[model samples]
Target: MHTIFEPMKPIPFSPPRIDEKTIEAVTEVLRSGWITTGPKTRELEKKIQQYIGGGPVLCLNAWTNAVELMLRWMEVGPGDEVIIPAYTYAATANIIIHIGAKPVMIDCEPNGFLMDLNKAEAAINENTKVIMPVDFSGLPVDYAAVMEMAKRHAGIYKPRGENQSKLNRIMVISDAAHSFGALYDNTPVGREVDVAAFSFHAVKNFTTAEGGALVFNLPAPFDNEAIWKDINRKALHGQTKDALSKTQAGQWQYDIVEAGYKCNMTDLQAALGWVEMDRYAQDHLPRRKSIVARYNQAFQSCSWAILPKMQDDIVESSYHLYALRIQGFNEDDRNALITHLAEMGISTNVHFQPLPRLSFYKNMGFQESDFPRAFEQFSNEISLPIYFDLTDEQVDCITSAIKDYMQSR
Candidate 1:
């Protein structure tokens, strides 16, 4: 007979896959004298570039900081608008607010977590400087569609700074925090957009304790390497050389080119990322894929289940979140399921509550009713746990709990 699972030892929602390997790498970094933003950070950037085969990658302190710096580099400020989806984390809009730019929020498609491209196109005007599409739950947005939209709107595009003048159109910056290893058009997600910002927070599939990165792939007439250098300098207080380079003989003398933000990644964080990147493609991602598959198998036959969009011909998700929706289930039903699971030693979460529902955005005159689809998607959505360390048995247990709850109801 099988023993009953107990709530005393509850399953975590999304824990970092910290093993002996991660411990060893971090220990080595601690032992080294030079610990902050050193060789390991640079090495991790290179590894990320190689893995994605995109433009130069720059690792920074957080996704919010990296993308905010990108906006500052583009000189987006008052009277400029950056279009974004309504269904996403607060950080997506917070970064825009930090730059004094308006975040023109658009509603998601009906029964979808991603923004409606048709509505997005209609929402564009001359003040629109950037279009930051989020890859919700590791599933990449239609980046090519966004690029085409930008090109179509080039005639009405307004240029603020040198960087904006060079592009001569709305910039497409992807909020790919959950899609580090995902693919769009059979290539990595970072390649299609002008810039892709990824999060390496503790709960992500690829973790570095607390960090993020940017992959630059701007079109011609814009030198990516120079932009990378400029961003590197900007991330380090606009200093001519980083701490690692300043250590070299006769390199002590450096000048501050601009008053830049301090958001560079440290060696300790980079070391953890390095260890993750070393086995990411070969080991970590495959395991996530397996868990997603198991969840899919369990829910496919259920009439009430609306499975997440994991993969298709054009795109493949990184499987960051298994946001499963239930048909005919209201918000109360979803919360009930979560509470029931918690009582049975399982943990589940909701991906988001939609930005308009939040007090800050709502106070900004953004009514939740305006984005009906976003509210519809958020009301019934449930994000199940999917991580590298989640075992097959645990997957079954979690699925069984959900099935039991639904069937009983």
Candidate 2:
């Protein structure tokens, strides 16, 4: 155990980088009186659409809700199956379950957290309605390969007894929680896939305190305006008009189209988002990238460390996480290392436990051995602190502590 002369300062793993500007913006919203879905939210949506090129952006209370809404909009339900990675957060699979669909979990690439396209191809069946790929730790997946796979499997993988001649397009929904600012082949992440749901949680790179957005890039003949309107109604109590629209003269009365989920983003949250989005590329992304580079350099000298890959010909990550794998470390050893880091006043976290390892998923017939690569990566991975405000000295201290712990072990 490490002892300290002065009190050991707790370094939180990942905290919101809120400053005076964010505080002031939130205060402004509070003072504005219209705190619900209003002008601010619309402005934020527009700005986000512009930021990620052009697309139909819909703001929501959470990314989970956005994904569920997308599933609902796409008409994915019972007798349907959605392909997802076994290594992702439960929310990705849970949403499919929510809509009465089968979540066909696939194995990740060897030593990499992203989905293996080959395994994804093997998992596709007649019932496969969607291929939901996750951009794990801000690294964009191979969108072109996924697109090609979807095209190849379109005609053959149709409902049993249905006309095999008609191409059954498998929608590609991207769970882009950590990839708001990520890029695939110089194009933004949102525009790469058919649809993408981005998280603006406090811990994410670009935050709205507690918010998320969906970007739709549907093909021709699909009315983007109609889809946008339906999503807007569905998010706001299924009402024909939102509070802002109803407040206008001679528009007080409206009708409920469907029983929809109440998951609209508030103006207060959007106010912070608007400011954060403006400064994201200029201030936040570069700082986080710098931190990741420093961490990579520090761990490069350690033989036991297997750093996360951030480079590729087709992708550029947003640096949302620095997931480091410790060679020759079991789950217990990783836990012991985390405890050791805590004792040394450094905080760390595990990205996820393979979904099958969890009791709920296990009860649902998933097994750990079914996803060998995911389980292996999950057991050894540790996410270090990498945020905008984390200083260079703190980075040095964190690396030194890890080196010392490794030597001691």
Candidate 3:
């Protein structure tokens, strides 16, 4: 009955850290019988607004929906261009194409996975309407530089040969899927940008099972209340009222205002979010930070390990993913290392493959050489197991496996 060599139970890269509170909240939601976009969802939105500072927060089914909805709200359409980082989840750039707008990919910073602000500025043209900076792996991109670039470009550029007062007023839409609890310059990620879409996917730090929230920081003339109502309509089949709204007596009558997508967050999902948010900073974040610190301490001595920067004066990551780069390793070498880790019962993953290398974007004319840094990082990066329940012993095993694999090679 000795099971000592039984593959160490297969440590997952990232798993939802659910607890009894989440269970109770979900059960309460089930008993309430009013589950679709109801009180709990509104409560979650209000809590998120307070958590990230004052801003309009709209809960949705996914960050993808939030991004697409924001693009639609801004009237981004065919012939319009949206600048995005080459190193990001497909959701960040895919929404641009989904709205028929062209996605202009930008390179990442050298030795960093964040968007290259200089390249982003250079990519701006007359047709550019949005500068979508992804907070890759929870590290906030330099928003100050991005905002400055947007301001500097405001007056000189002209779109469609029209003379507008500010040509450089590109909307700053942050793909903050990995940075919900992250901060830039002491301000939360959502509040700093014009708008940010946060993912609450099952594997995210904060899980809503399958949900997201849109944080809007656009200034005057763009009424936050109106925008909220518009997004609500859009999320629920363009209907004037949702299921909860219709539940009230003599209020069942509603109408479709415009053609919209079904992407509203259910109360069931929000129930989980409410509990997760309550414990976010006080409980969850601390544990994750501890795990990251342990991982950093373990791997910092390795010459071949290029660890991700977790914090600085201007940035504080959410510690969403630990992207470990294998220095001097090619794509094949990295792949071999991952395979070797798997053989030793350590689970690992890659954050992403640069969008340009994907067949869809490649066929759209993107070149790997177009973004050398992103490609370089993509070729050698591996995301290690990081979660609340991962034991210190498991962490040591993962690091040891990596070191053994590299040294033996």
Candidate 4:
């Protein structure tokens, strides 16, 4: 009863590829006497800034807190509204709540996962402080359009504090969790947005085990180094001196500047980042791109196969997730197909379920009907296996399995 093409091994969704070089780097950090937030963390910040073409970079413990740090720096709080796409992960909106700011959930693009700029424009009002754009599926949003929209509505934007008044415009805190190396019109994600937050979680294209970063790309009058110092202070219990600095002979005494949250990145995590960043542009990205290219090549001719975007001249993805959409497949049938694939040893996943549809948002009076397009994206979408170690033959197997599943239906 079994076919000759049956899967020989289990396929995981996404796994970090840690080679011996990465292991040795982490081991070196372990051997180093200072294991806390110290030299390695600072080095990672510098390397990230260099990689991003000179912007303020803060290495943190999670992507969520990284965004919160920017919001806190912006002084976003009660009565302020932050616009977020309903199609992204929850943390994108949760940080808004953490800062006592309201989250205005908006529908995604009519046929895509990114935020709909037209809808976002209409949603902005006097209370709108930030527009958090997510780079869903590793494809960067239209940065120029987003800025132009913000500029158009600049007259209505009200500044609550010194930083807000100094900037005098709505901040675009791009939630670029899925897009580390993604580019929009020759500009990196971090460079294109006001402040972009990135995740280095295990499942992402690049991993630091459990780490994140915040990058600044603001204009003149905003001192990048001064802001970096403020963020550094904010992340470490507002301590004037860090542990490394305290280790110095006469620098032991310090003061707590303000009540700050603790989410500083450690030397162990930064060690992983140093290795991964070195490999990303040269090895990891290309390998992931090849896997996606193979998937696209196999599925392009099929009528039901709605392909994911790999790149255009204007937008280049980090090749993070292979979000494949199947035409005419409803939610029920999509779930069925997922079960079928799992039975065959091929793992599949849904990119998102749209925030408004979740129970928490529903209890807050937000409806799934408000975000029809997000539901449409969630219904038929299936993210394929897309890690660096996936093989060409396995890619063929995945495509063949999908074709067979479609045929069965």
Candidate 5:
């Protein structure tokens, strides 16, 4: 008897959608010789602002840094508490800690990924300064409900800083890393909250190689444009003028206002984002939605499968991730299923492990058992590949692998 080896499928979990257009745009930026936070970056920011149709948009290096800047600007510090769901990625909670603020982790809604607004409301106190709700897997967390909750707690909100005083209420910053094109109440997500941060990381629906943006919709008298300018400075060592402006004749003189962090988006990175933005609404998003629809159809009849909510009357996801849940699956069962799928040459991932389960948050005295709903979600959740480049055949292969594994079990 002769032993033979089988070739594995070449399917990736999530890859950036790169094409000639992207290459050409990047090449153009490279040839321009003014790559760091120049015209290309500004162009991308303007394009994002126009597409969102919300407020001023400020594009920065990564989602984590961009949002951390916003938190710093809001003056959130040690004694302040920011409400967030424990079901999100570590970046969500890490940023809170980075800013010296306490992250008041709460449970997810009974059967959903979004944070429970009731739990969030109950967690509020005089120290509560912000409510950073994540749009997990691109599904919008009831923005209206979160906004109303913030408003209801206005009486107890303590404004420690000028920016916080301006709002006079707890700010609602949407961790919209996965929801660049999602809609809430038929409107784009950015406008729903006071500020929404979008990630253009390689794996996100919209990729910039590495980038993120903050769309400000702060209420009247706040001057979002002024805030955008201020954040631009804050993102660049608090410099009076960006490198692009400083390059001009007789514009060399500048001053630093605050000791800020360096996380400005480079022109080369923005070029990729600009090209993707061009085809996002027409090509990228539709294809992702189609893939999700196919997945939903493939698993809908299975008794063990629980399909993710992509769209409802109030919200529409960007179809960033197909977060499927296996009914009655425990942590061990889910891990085994993942291994089985891997053996079949299919790539799958858990959207998150829940912050409390991780070593850092756990040591912070955050227990997984305390947030039972979050733990329940994490134990059985599987994030399947859903990207613009993924073909229908690949989707079928993935679905077949999952069904085969579940049926065998």
Candidate 6:
């Protein structure tokens, strides 16, 4: 019974690849005695901005904060309606609820992870202030199409204040939690949209354990630096000075500009992020792509395989989540497949169950039946493991398992 596959070799869904360099970086931060938001945190922000090719980047505690902060900064409150896709995690719409704004959800495109832009256009009105599109499975949405849609509805845009007045259209803040290094037309994900918020959550391709950032790329008339300062201050209890500034002689006294929430990233987290960021495009991404290629090759001939798009000439993913779908399969079929995979020492996940289907949103009057496209995408979806450290053998085992189950039926 000789076999290449290790029967008991456990493969996690998305295990982080924190190497010696990352550990050393974090250890140095710990040894430096400046643990909380400090030099390392600021340095990571700058590095992210440079990598994004010109944007005022500000690090936050979570992607949720990045989304909420964008809404708060835009003064999108009561009576404002932010258009969103029904096919995303709750975090995307929860921010709108947090700000007392309405999240007008549009159904996803048929068999697609992204929102239906036509539905988005139809959803727009005088109350529409922003459009939050999720970068599902690390794939970039059509920013150009969304932007063009927003422009067409310019005449109906209602401005609440100076920030809203500057832009005579709906603001697009992409919830790019899964798309750190994804590309659209050779431009990075952050640059394509008005502003993009990326997550570095523990399971994400890029990890700081838990952190997020917003790329400030507001074109003309809008002071990008001022926007960064504003968001930075808001993320840190509205204090006039950050800890780095307070460390200076006679600068101990500071003013509270306004009541703000605390959502700043720590130096320890930033140290890990610095290491991950440096290796992302170079080492991590290439390996992840290879793993994906292995899965694609293995599943290429399967009749039921609806493989997740890796990339084409115009778009490339960060290879965050390998969300595979089983054609003509329902929720029961997908869950059974997950159970079968689990029995064989492989871990799998579902990309998302559309927000409308959740209990909370259901209680809030959202029905799963309303977003038919999203539900269709969800029912048969299963996210496979794809990380920098995932091996070709493991990919083969995982894909073989999937194909076996698929073909048996």
Total backbone collisions, model 6: 0
lDDT, candidates in the order shown: 0.91, 0.87, 0.85, 0.88, 0.90, 0.88
CA RMSD per model (angstroms): 1.6, 2.6, 3.0, 1.5, 2.7, 1.6
User: Higher-TM-score candidate among 3 and 6?
Assistant: 6
Candidate 4 residue 50 Cα shift, in angstroms, is: 1.4
Error of model 5, residue 71, in angstroms: 1.0
lDDT tens digits by residue: candidate 1, 80-163: 999999999999999889888899999998767998999999999999999998999999999989999999999999898798
Q: Write the per-residue lDDT of candidate 6 for residues 1-409, one digit (tens) a residue.
A: 1133557688999988877898899999999999999999989998888888867888888999977988899999999999989888888888899999999998988778988888888888999999888888988888888888888888989898889999878898888999988888886678877898999889998999999999988878988999999999999889999998899999999999899999999999999999988888898988988888888887787778898887777888878888899999999999999999999999999978898878989999998888888898899999999888888878878887777777667
- Model 6 residue pairs with clashes: none
| Reference-based TM-score, model 2 | 0.96
Clashes of each: 0, 0, 3, 0, 0, 0
Q: Over all chains combined, what TM-score does candidate 6 have? A: 0.97
lDDT of 1: 0.91
State the lDDT of candidate 3 residue by residue for 109-185, as single tens digits: 98999988888888887778888888888998888787777667766544442212223377788888999899887
Could you tell me the lDDT of residue 71 within candidate 2?
83
How far residue 394's Cα lies from its native spot in candidate 2, in Å, is 0.7
lDDT of 2 by residue, 18-51 (tens): 8899899999999988999999999999998998
**CA shift of 374, model 1, Å:** 1.0
State every prediction's TM-score relative to the real structure.
0.97, 0.96, 0.95, 0.97, 0.97, 0.97
What C-alpha root-mean-square deviation, in Å, does candidate 3 show against the real structure? 3.0
Q: Report residue 167 deviation for candidate 6 (angstroms).
A: 1.8
- Write the residue-wise lDDT of candidate 4 on 164-207 in tens digits: 99889998888889999887776556787778889998899878
> Which candidate model has the greater lDDT, 2 or 5?
5
